[model samples]
Target: MKRGGAQHEESIIGASLVAATLGLSVPAMALEVTPYGAIRVATWWTSSTYYNPAGDPLHDADFTLDLQGDSYVGMRVKEGDFSALAELGAYNPKNRSAGVELRMLFGEWNFGNGKLRVGYAPSPYVYRSEMIYDADGGFNGYASLFDGRYAQIKLSMNNGFYLALMRQENVGLAGIGATNSPTTNAGNGYINTPFNMTSTTYMAGYTDFDTFMPKTVLGYEGKAGIVTYGGGVAGNYYKIRTVAGNVQTGKDEIYSYLGFAHAKIDLAPFEIKVAGHTAQNLGNLMNNAAAAAGSFYSNNPATGKNAYTYGGWGQLGYTLNNKVKMFTGVAYESNEMRGRTSDDRMAAFANLQYAVTKNFNIVPEFAFLNEMRSAAGTKQERIYATGIKWEMKF
Candidate 1:
């Protein structure tokens, strides 16, 4: 009886060991990985009076053939509740082969009817136009407000509502204008507001300024029948300190905010979209040519007030056949500052995309940009560009 009881005990122990070994050997959820990329090249001719100021000589029209900066390669990995994406942009319009750029690198997790995304990725607040004229989408400057990709921590619901905390820029310099590199004549139409102090990029010093918090972005989007719509608002705050010989004399708190909305309707062969925004001190938060044209105002240092900007763009697209499609759009933006000069600009574009195959597309597009208004004593320029872009997706 004792021997039988011992055998029974040994059998129970063996069973437990086998069960533990099987649990250890079984692999966790298998990760599914996918790779994707696209290659794009554009050869086009462009003519513009943008670079020629009043006293500058007339420049000849220029032609260029280069890789579109938007081309990218990326990998997506998913493991049960977790997913990640790493993408690298292929080219830089400014320098074709400078190096690959980190377009997006982020990890996301699905939890409790929501998603948590962390790292550098496209801003949740971004809405782009279908104007495929330049290497990047053409109307990004004049109409659409693209905050670009930056570091952020975002939480989004399955219901299309999201919030994010993004990196902040300390735009506290006095007499600030032209927030970004002026690639087009958009910047040429502006004269820096007259102030006793010149523009400086010294916002990082302890005596210069203080960024109180990250930029906050909140947005929501959803589809209702054949119509889709979305909108969001963003804002940031910073304080600028006056330091004379390393002694803090005074400080000023600055606040910037913006609100944007977009709507689209799809009916068979016809598609329509419209988007717009209104903002104060837009350049302090993001970089866009139109935003730079209407950035913060410090013309009167003693009575400084932020600049304001408003603009909208609309597109009408039609499908001609299985292989061809046509799209036309118009965009306009205006910048105003009380007690100072204001600026306005308008743009229009038309394009036809022909699909040679499911993966190949040829788009011939034409675009026009006009500076509708400029400061006193400044000459505005008109720009015209026609180009063909070849894109292949894999």
Candidate 2:
């Protein structure tokens, strides 16, 4: 019986070898798939009073409990040199309708010390802060340069060099025409100034607003011993066909540019991260709060003017032990616009994370935000918030 079993095993091995030599059917390497996610919920007692650009008080303090926008589910697939990822983010789960949307979906090909990545993913230019305020918002407008996610094609090398062409942030004009609202109709438009100066009139509307080229970014990242650092530059261009009433006016060209850098240093239980940027006509690069406060774009497209914005943030973290960690950070940003009061903002935050288990944590935090200067030179508002966030990962 033993001799017969050995003969059968030898026959199977010989058949497998023959199959390989003849390119016959054979079992292939199995694909690897991993599903992972995190659920985050928090309770916040926030107090603040909002003021308009004119310094008029608008709203009072409030308190709320909700799910953090960072809560998400993701899947990763890998097969040898190729890999893919898909993630969905859930926002405002406490609302009647939870906002569930695609956060990232991308595929990458690895070849010869570099990678080719394609599809929608977080912009490589973004270096998020450690601030956990407002569900890890990282004080986006106040200091951090978060370009958000975009559909892009990126090429990155192992040696810290990368380049990408991404969807352009289209520029638009508002508060134009006779009325305070934007006008799409063809007519003479007037631009109202915050100051007592006379209003500027122009061909009221623009037609054929388009960007001829995609936004481009070039950067490098490298690490040595206990430190990591990188910097990059980006540029974009767009044009608009101007119109004075029904008469076709000349076209206006707009250009946007940005330069940014960041550094991270780690030593044992201590770590530090710092980042900063300076830019012109950031347009859609920043969020609504940042753009509105900074007056990032020209009020009148005809002027072809762009404002300058710059800001930075830094954080220090300390690990107390295997189950506890603490962090503190500050962020500040400012902008200078022509014919308007430059706006500046600052924020400070501190938090402590306690590990409840290997896959769960409890974080208690406090944050403060101050609007030092508004575009209209008004004292905007100050916010103070204290909260506890609970998170579970799988």
Candidate 3:
């Protein structure tokens, strides 16, 4: 559920517009625009992890220590039907240098019935769970950011279903240590399954990925009194062409796909949700490895291949009054890559905004993860961090 993105430039742009529009008129920010974003700064220290190019970033394939993922900033905006976001951050492990991260920069056209009208936006396929939720709605987690936003038109049915067709960002659902070469955006994946059916190039016989291809999604939100509930379904089409006139490989690609379900129940002080998602790329883990002499190779095609992946998260929270709120979540994910690895993760989030105070307030949260990197190889290291945020409407 990664929501952080670009903050410096866009946030500045928003603030400056407000300044220019109402030059010292009244309470200044009072006469400002209805939608705006802000700068978010955070600092922290940690140990373990951190990787690089040559291979096994942690070591030469043999090193054990802790590192830090500190110093980062992000910006987000939600104004009427137009919105965008960004995040500029870095990570260091002493022994290795640092690099730039393209957090996010996507926009949307929100319309009647809660449907995005048009424009490019981050691929919702990256998430398996809701990002933020209340009596309103929620979003999926950030599993693929580098894949970049997709360009597409959206159609929303008043019934609560939405659809978008766009270019694929992550065609290969392989894991971080995948044997097959992966797309830049898919670098270091969450999937543990070693085998994949991602297309490497055209003429070489290409195919589509689960999250990369054009997609159509459907969802609905309704409440049984105080109990809030909603769920969504999505599908991806796999197809591609060859630059060369002729160099045939396979006729059709193994279909890549994803599915999800979620709910929110207010049984008193606690508003709980049980959500689960299962996805399986077109490929075989065991046979693919065997096809390439047991080495990860794109040559090991998913011809008549079948593989699977699944995960879920639970959210627990309490609503205070009609504004302040807090929540905690636990999650589990299992991928079939790298032998077998699974992820056991924990998260805590709280948003306290007072409509009584200009409908703006501070939102802060923390998330911790410990990949059980063992049989089913999950995250062995623990990741913990916190964030503070602000929101305002004119």
Candidate 4:
């Protein structure tokens, strides 16, 4: 029986070798596929006055357990110089029920020293940081200056230069009863300004097809020994359409621009990163609570221009052995609109991450924010959270 089994095994090996030599191997013709996912559980607390002003003032706090942060699944494929990726995650801006959303989907074709890519992907303007415990690092920090994913076509060189053309969309509407209000039957519209100039109302312009255009970006990155640096600039165009009782009256266009720079250094056990940006009509990009794209206005009806803004963030990280890490960072942004109250936002955070296993981690983090000013009045908020995350690959 042992001799018969050995003979059968030899016959199988010989047949496989012959098939491979004849170009008939099924395995060799198959494409490789990989899958990955993560799950996270966190308990979070926030000052009730900050998020719920109408509730009981005596309670003063809100808390909940969430499983939405950093939970996702992705797949990667590569065949020679061509590759593609698709990643999805649970996202809900209103903090209601979690909804599956596309995070990344792109394909690249590499040719020696350069590459071309198309689809929805991360903006090249972000600076990578080691902070892992906070949800706002990339979304609310300096990276927020140009943080949203975009559908674009990009060309990049190995030496760190890149350019992209992206689609732009309108995201703001004029406040109720303003001149630009759709209900107003006027050929020209204006965003109403307070008599005392304490607040400015953002206007929603017309969405005529003729006013739409593509945005452009140009950037470069480089490294020298322990230090790395990069920066980019972008130009955007926006148009506001005048409404006369639901009829198109006239249209006005405005141009806005942004510029940013970032630098990072690695020194033994610690790493530090600093980044900053200045922009006009960038509230859409920054995702701040009190600002939106097209929120900044010149008040002059003829120009109908958007306002400018600026902000920056910095972080320092220390690695304490392979199992533990620590990070601290500060971020601030201010709107440049005149006579606007509480238009500045600021935050600071610190956290400790401990690796419980190769695929599991525990992080404790603290965050604070001062809403320099908001529609709800100035309020200070605090967040304390402990997160447990597990990641795996197949």
List model 4 lDDT by residue over 70-156, tens digit each: 566666766688887777665543443334556788999998999999889867776644444344344354334545577889999
The better candidate by lDDT, 1 or 4, is: 1
Worst 10 residues of 4 by lDDT: 194-203
lDDT (Cα, tens digit) per residue for candidate 2, span 1-394: 3567557645744553453344323225445667688999888888887877567776666777888888987777677899888777775454424345568989999997999999998777788876777777777777777656778899999998999988665545433222211222223232343221122354355444544777899999999899999999988776555455767655556678889999999976999999998988775443233454464566554433577888889999999999999999998888877767788889999999999999999999999988876776788788889988999999
Residue 163 error, candidate 1, Å: 0.8
Model 4 regions more than 4 Å off: 1-26, 51-59, 93-98, 128-143, 173-209, 247-250, 284-304, 339-342, 375-394
Candidate 1's residue-wise lDDT over 1-394, tens digit each?
2567557645644654454455445556365666678899998898887434554535458899998999987777777899888777764787643455778989999997999999998766677766887675758778678756878899999999999998665444444322322222122221362221223443322334455688899999899999999999999887666545455555667788889999989986999989999988877767443455556645456434777889899999999899999999999888777755577778899999999999999999999987755633255777889999999988
List CA RMSD, all candidates.
14.2, 13.4, 10.5, 12.5
Clashing pairs in 2: 203-244
Off by over 4 Å in 1: 1-29, 51-59, 95-98, 172-207, 242-251, 297-299, 302-304, 375-377
What TM-score does each of the candidates earn?
0.80, 0.80, 0.53, 0.75
How many residue pairs collide in each prediction?
0, 1, 33, 8
